[model samples]
Target chain A: MTSLSTDAIPHAQSYRGLVARRLAILVGLAAVLVLSVAVDVSLGPARYALGDVLRTIVAPGAADLQMRVVIWDIRMPMALLAVTVGASLSLAGAQMQTILANPLASPFTLGLSAAASFGAALAMVLGVAIFPAAVGLMVPINAFAMAMAASLLIFGLSTLRGVTVETIVLLGIALVFSFNAALALLQYFASDQALSAVVFWTMGSLTKATWGKVAITAAILALCTPLFARRAWALTAIRLGEARAAAMGVPVRRLRLEALVLVSVLAAVPVSFVGTIGFIGIVGPHVARLLLGEDQRFFLPGAMLSGAVILSATSVLSKALLPGAVLPIGIITALVGVPFFAALILTKGRKAW
Target chain B: MVSLALEQVGARYGRREILSDATCAPVAGGGLTALVGANAAGKSTLFRRIAGQLRGPGIVRLEGAAPHDLRYMPQDTGMSAALTVYESVILALKQGGGGWRLSAAELAAVDDVLHRFGLADLAQRQLPELSGGQRQSVSIAQTLVSQPKVVLMDEPTSALDLFRQYEILEALRRYAEETGAVVILALHDLNQVMRACATTLALAEGRIIAAGPTLEVLTPEMISRLYGIDSRVERCSRGCPMMIVDGPSGQARAG
Candidate 1:
């Protein structure tokens, strides 16, 4: 029989130390995210001082009325929207990478955002509503509906008898191309007004972010975080491989389905609200993976924080890159995400994935 | 009192039946059982059948152990996860129902298994950085950290060096003896099987040809039938039993 030894103290301490170190890294990411959000809020056409914005946020009634209105009513929603949407998309991508066992798998790459864009373009160009009851809120509702449909399609295909991960990824790419082609066809038949609206919507902007949208996205992120946290060990075990995870008493198929369903909602809600901010879904989880590894406990939160930081920083860049005009956030994200992703791949090489 | 008995346990991938009617005696716990077979002889298929990953026709009966108490480590060494050795072992240990936090007992269990498997020094090394032999040892640690009552490991020592393989097999034997686990490991090295395993199960072409004590189940005729190779069972200068391979059996001819 193996008994507890004096050396056990050191090993346990070392492990505890490692855990503390990871948690500290998470705290650092959260700090960076907070600073990014603050900087994101401080920038805009009005150009409020950072100190005034913080004071207005801390004590709304005592601050200047104009600054209060600008910071809390307008800028705060946009900034928080970036945070929630970023966290949602990143968590969705992280879990997608986990369940599908493909590092390239993400809400954007798997055609959910493309499907949402198609849905939104249909509403803008053809005045078509996927869900008739929500006709007044046609664009976002239709986007949510079509995104769910696409996610469910992928989920259903994944549950088939013999479909592999590569097959799912290939199917997603096919969906992306098919939806983009269909969207182009719709744009071709549209009025100039409708066409311009469709084009701008595809560009992806945080300028139209509202408090209601922020609340809905934040609520969804809150709902999904605990569910992913509860299965943290199982999700981490899955990275070892499906067979090993199943052998460890993890219901692999069920877990994957559940996670896919959650990922579907997570990706669907944010893309519906924010149009098509696509890069966070692909890059956020990878950043978290590079830093925190895939221990879902840390990786989950790390992904959310990293995504929030990246997107909030992107939002700030969108406003800061030009003097008064807000550049399309999508262009900035892609421009930034590609170089950062490439740098990570080049530096870490094949080890990080 | 833990025991594992397979009655007509069969598995298939689509239409190709890999294992068929593989019945064996109730192998008792507290010792090593070697599963010896050729490359295409359905050793992994049998383990998958028993592990319940594949289903066709089978009755995998266990005594004094629940299905939940079983753990199967497949013969895969391509673990490319970014988790370190300690984290990977802890991941296995906390599967099924652990909460967010790790308890002291859990940490002790992981530490004990790592040290037992000679993986303590490499505890902080990431999985992708390890060599094939080191990866196999890490796999062994991951498999046993949970302290399952029944264990199935396919080709567990295939990638290990000679000394590491021997040491791991000995550690597994001791682990089985201490915990009374029904441990079955698929191994290609028959000499290692003879040295460590108390019971031997011979599989050939999806059939369980024999199951008995290592010496009784492994013979010149049985070796020939299993691998299409002519071999001799002899003793080394240290009086340890060893398999001496001569050549391919007369039944097999290379084209």
Candidate 2:
């Protein structure tokens, strides 16, 4: 018989260490977010100093209309929108990697984003179901509907043949190509107004983001967070393979489906607003895994925070780089995500992150 | 309450029947059972059938209420090398419901299992960092941590060197005694068959050649049939019965 128990050992040190590390990360994220918002507010045709903005936020009576408009309408919406989209995309990407057990598997890898792009394109270009008299906001409606529809399509296609990992990924890739082709066709036969709309949709933008869209997307992601996190333990088991996973009571098939659904919702909601923001899903998970280790408890939130940090910073940069011009959020994310992805590939790629 | 029986158990891969109507009785309660044979002797296939990994009508009966009562350590270390030893063992315990609130006691037990096989310091080490022997040691610890009533280990020591092999076999025997778990391992090494197993099931071409008490069952004729060579039954230092194959299908070997 063994003489010692982990219970007998004092792990206060480990606990303290983890707590400190987590707090540091959270503080760093908060600092970056705060700094980015500061930069955003102090920018544009009318600049608001840090002291002035802080006082305005706290002592509203002292603030002028321009300051109020800058803080509330322009900067606040952009910052909030960036945080929401970034967190949702990262969580989806991180969970998909674990579920598919492939670091390369992300929102984009499963064709969900491509399908969303198509859906967004169709709504913007065709105005298919846009009734100018009633709900003039057809693109958003079309975007959400088609994004969810694309998600369901990928889900259905993967499960149509019994959910094997290889089959799911292959089907997702195939669907991605199919949806991209459809989007291409939509692009080919568009009016001048429709052409720019379609191009803008593909390029991705958070400039049109409003509090309503952020709230809706946030609600969906919040609902899915638990389901995504619940599989942390099972994802650990699945890495051992299906036979071992089953042997361990993981219910491999059901877990696979649950993960697929969770990721789809996570990806669909974000893509509904941003179209196919490539690499956020792919690189976010890698960053999470690398920074927080492979433990899902930390990986999930780490990825979300990392995504938020990247987007918030990028939003500020994109706005700064193009004065009085709105750069596509997709390009900013691509610029930020691609180099990190290459770094992940160069380093941890061989390490199986 | 813990007995396993396989009847008319046959398996196929496409057109090839790896195990054909294999039948065996429960040998003994405590020690190892060497399902010994040549490379393609269907030992691994039989283990899979028993473990319920491969679907075949094998009239398989396991006494435990849950499959966790039985453990299968696949020959392929089948564990992802990307994970750490702590993570892998934690999974085995999780499956067994060893308890989610891993107190110091339980966590120590997890670590101790590693230490028993010289893996104490390597608990946090990733599987890829492990040598073949270290990986096998971790795999064994994962299998035994559940205190499984029946653990079907396919070549548990196949990856280990000579000394490490003994360490693993000794660990298995101790585990069986401590937990009273029925341990079955498939082995190609005849010496290992002699060292740990209390019984032997000699299989050749998807059929049992001889099986019973390890002493009586492992004979010159049986080893010859299993290994397809001229063999002589011999006695090791501890008076345990073993076989010596002088050459493949040649003569003049006696012990």
Q: Residue by residue across A173-280, what tens digits does model 2's lDDT show?
A: 887899889988998998889899788888878877777877887788789877666666676677766766765667777787777788777777777776667767
Model 1 pairs in collision: none
Share of reference contacts found in each model:
0.65, 0.26
Best by TM-score: 1
Q: What is candidate 2's CAPRI-style docking category based on DockQ?
A: acceptable
Query: In candidate 1 chain A, what residue range of length 10 has the lowest lDDT sum?
Result: A1-10
How many angstroms is residue A143 displaced in model 1 relative to the true structure, after the best TM-score fit? 1.6
Instruction: Supply the DockQ value of model 1.
Output: 0.54
List model 2 lDDT by residue over B192-228, tens digit each.
8887888888777676667787767777677666565
Docking class of 1: medium
In model 2 chain A, the worst 10-residue window by lDDT is A6-15
RMSD to the native, candidate 2? 4.2
